[model samples]
Every structure is written in structure tokens, then in C-alpha cells.
Target: MVKQMEERHSIWLRIFHWTNMIAITLLVLTGFYIHAPESFRLFSNMDTPRMLHFAMAYVLVFGVIGRVYYAIVAKDAKNVLFNPIPDIKNLPSMMKYYLFLSDSHPDYGKYNPGQKMMYTGWLVMAICMIITGFILYNPNLFMGLGGSLGGLIAVRVIHYIINWLFVLSVLAHVYLDVSEGIPVLLSMFTGKIPKGFHDSAHTHDKSIGA
Candidate 1:
């Protein structure tokens, strides 16, 4: 059977997604080496990794800005941004689907509640990392803010903890995406999905309602 292709992601969104992924992957690797020069042997010396880390930090910063701009102008924010009241109400159904207790979940716009939560989380985490990273990067520049945030030590701890969170979250994201089937994964690259793919979720919801 032929599967019609439908555009799920825009060209710019795909660009930003891949670029952000690359930037984050480099940041994590460099972060590990920087965190423990003795343990992570990915980098031979501090110079290269430190330089790369700083460069990728800037890359991610711009990526985030551009992605947010695109989301706003393209009217895509509604698809991913979590709306507290409605999202809270819809969370149970999404949880049931993931837990195998339910076969279908509500059609919560382009993204379901869980995806909205994760994507929203990554945004929050990214912002936190950026702020903490700068504080750590330039102690003197952010001296006042750093002191308010419990001094440089607190900022370092926040940066380190969030780095771990990013690693774990990315691992789960990769596994879940792969488990969903390659098409779902490929959609990130191709910006298209098999026709009727998204409809399947709502199909069951409607059937149950009827």
C-alpha cells in the first residue's frame, strides 16, 4: 500500500532541530571532559574541548533564538507550548496510553501533552543552562547575579545538574523515537510523515466516544 506523505515539520524547524542536536551533543561531550579531565577521554586536552564547548554554547544560543522566532512567526507555538489547565486535564489520557492502559489519547493539537511537556521542559532546561553557563563562563561579568544565585558554587552545581538531565532526557528521547517506528524518526529529517499516521491516535478516541 502506498502511504501519502504529509508535511509535519517545516524546513526551518528541521534545520533548527538538527543544528540544536549537534550543538547539544558537542556540549555534552565537552562538558563531560571539562567536568572530569581524568575520567572522560573523549578529549585529549582542555584546549580543544574548552574551545568547542564555548563555540557550541553560542551555536545553541542562536539556535534557540531562531527556533523561538520561527515558532512565533510560523504560528507553531501553539503546537508545542504547554497550556497548563487544558494540558493538566489531558495528562491522564496521555499517561494511560504510554502505560498501555489506554489504546488512544486525545488529539492535543500537533503534539500530545507528553511531547508538549518534554519539549517545553527542554526549552526551560536550555534557558537554565544558558544562564548558569554564562555565570560560570564569566565570573566577574555575572558576579552580582551569581551572588544572588548563591555565588559561583551554586551556579556551577546548577549547570552540572542540568547537564546530566539533558543527557538522560536525550537518551530517553532517542529510545522512544526509535520505538515509535523509523518513520517517526525520519520525519525529523524529512519533515514529513506517512499520511494517516497522526490520525490513528484520534481515530480510537473518536471510536470510543461513539
Candidate 2:
């Protein structure tokens, strides 16, 4: 039987998701240019790359802030934040479902435990990227701790290390989207999903009901 899906994503959610796609792509492009070897310079001057990188950072930060705020204010946002379902208790089973070993796992209402885990991981990583980013932004502060400290140089190393983590997360995020998020995105863009998809993704049918 064809299952009619409940509309889970609203207009604002779709907008934010796509907005992030643009901003993040630009940020990554400029960021790589800035961090890449000088011999492989993409720009005639460092000024353009630096400015664009910073500008994209600012936009990304605002998006992150908005996401957090929405988590507190929006019901769907709770799926990622509060995540009432999916704890250590259910992780094993959910993993099986993802691997296709099981026909199904527990039904999710907003987000599955697996989805919540990824969301929570990214939220925290984004925040850390912001904070550690500032630390590198001002290395003199680290020097105050001790003159022997490499100061900003040390901070640069730390920042550089974290940057890779964020990069890896993005790669993983892309892969997951290709797997499950693709279907979700299609649903968001079209405002519909396979009815069975809705039943499996969310816990309560009533919440998704039109």
C-alpha cells in the first residue's frame, strides 16, 4: 500500500536548510583557499579570500545561532535537541536497522535516535569550532598564561586540528544525506513522503497528520 506522508518540514525549515547549503559551500571554498599552500594560490591577493572566508563565517555563525534558538522555540527542533527517544538503550537496535539486519526498529516521532545523535554531534562541534576559533583569533591571551607558550602559534595548531574535524563531519554529513537525508530532503522540498516513510521516521502519526 502507498503510504501518504505527513508534512514534517515547514517553509522556514526548508529555507534554513538550503541557506546553509549555499553558505557552507562558499565557506568551504574560501576556507580551503586560505588554508591551502601558498604555492597553489587561487587568488591574486590574500585579501579577497580572507574577506570572503570571514564573511561566510559570520553568516554561518548566525545560522548556527538561529538553529539553536529554533530548537528551543519550535516543536520539530525538539527532535534534534531534547530527543526524548533514542538513548544508549536503543542504539544497538537502531544500528541494526541502519545495517538492514532488522525489518524495523522502534518507530520515531520526530527524529530517530540515530538522527538525534548526528544532530547533537554537529551542534556541539559547530559550537566548539566557534569558541576555539576565537581562541586562535587572539593568541596573545594564550601567551598571558605563560610566555613559554607558543601563544597564537599554539592556538593556530589547535584551530587547524579542529578544522579538520569539522571537515570530516561535513563529509560524513554529506554521505548520510545521500543515504537517508536525501529522502527527507525530497520530502521537505516536495512537502510529501511515502506514507510508510512517515510511519517509520516518526513516533506519533497524529503529530504529522494533516
Candidate 3:
């Protein structure tokens, strides 16, 4: 069979994707260590992890900004951002397909409804994390914000909870991508996929459904 390829991710997107991935990974690790030094002895000293965590935080900040800018400039927001009415309507079909109760679902553009929801949620979560994080990092600077949110301790708790969400969601994201196939997983890195891969998969599923 002849293999044809198509662009699935742009160069700028791939850069942002990897940048965010690395920053998030480091942030999680360093975050855990910072949260419980005794429990998570990933690092021997607090200074190292604390410094690394703060550094990665800035990297993630820039990464998110760059990604959003690119999305708007490239008109790729529609491909990933969730549109409530239609996406909500399509969720049942997506859920059924994932549950193995159905073999095929109506096309959901670049991302399925669940994926769109998750990606959109991540964006929201990231923004929340940045806000809470800064409030904690510089309690003096964001004193008023922290006081409104119930102090630095509360902000810390919120940031920690969001970090856990990021960890769990990232695991789910990786699993779902790999489950789609190696091509789907590699597409992020290679920025290309076999042409008609998604279409062919859906067509086969439709045949099975029929």
C-alpha cells in the first residue's frame, strides 16, 4: 500500500507543544518535591527543586502565551476550542464510541468533543495555575488577591490541586493519543501523519457499524 502524508501540526505548534510538555513535566516533578520534601525525595536539596520549579513556571507561562497567539494567528483555535452546543450534542456519540457501545461516530473536525473539552479545560487550568502560583510565589505582591482568595495557604492548596489535575489529564491525553495508534502519537513530533488515516479509520468503523 502506498503511504501518503499530510501536515497535522505546524512547526510553531510542534515547538510550543514540546516546550509546554517539558515545562509541565519538570514543574510537576519539582512541585511534588517542593510540596513534600521528605515524601518526594526526587532532589536531595530544596533549593534545587524550588529554583527549577520557578524556572519551569516561567517557561510554561511563555509557552501558553505563544500557543494562544499562534492559534489565533493561524486560525487553529476552531480546531481545538470547544463549541458548547455542537460539542455537547456530539459528546454522546464520542462517549459511546469510546465505551465500545458504538463502532463509529460523526466526524468532529480536528478533535473529538471530549478532546476539545479537555484541551479547553487545560487552558483554563493553566491560567488558574499561573494566577494562584504567582500569588503564592510573591504573597507580598499579590497580597490583596491572596487575601480575597482566603490567604496564601488557600492559594497553595488550589495550585496543588490544579497540579494534580494536570498530572492526571496529561496521563489520559498520552494514553488516548497512543491508543489511536503510533501515527497519532508521532504526529506531534513529526508534524505529519499518513493521509486519510483518520478518514480510513472512521470509514472502517462505519462499515462495522453498518
Tell me the whole-model lDDT of each prediction, alpha carbons only. Answer: 0.88, 0.65, 0.89
Model 3 lDDT per residue over 96-150, tens place: 8888887777888889999999999999999999999899889999999999999
Best by lDDT: 3
Model 2, 189: alpha-carbon shift in Å? 2.9
How would the candidate models be sorted by lDDT, starting from the highest? 3, 1, 2
Looking at candidate 2, what is the lDDT of residue 186? 81
Compared with the true structure, model 3 gives a TM-score of 0.95
For candidate 2, the lDDT comes to 0.65
Task: Put down candidate 1 lDDT per residue, 1-210, tens digits, no spaces.
Answer: 677798999899999999999999999999999999998999789999999999999999999999999999999999989989999999998888888887777778888877888899999999999999998899999899899999988899999999999999999889978866677789998999887777764543423221
Better of 1 and 2 by TM-score: 1
Give model 1's TM-score versus the native structure: 0.94
lDDT score, candidate 1 = 0.88
What is the clash count for each candidate, in the order shown? 0, 6, 0
TM-score list, all predictions = 0.94, 0.76, 0.95
Runs in model 2 with CA error above 4 Å? 1-5, 39-44, 82-86, 138-150, 200-210
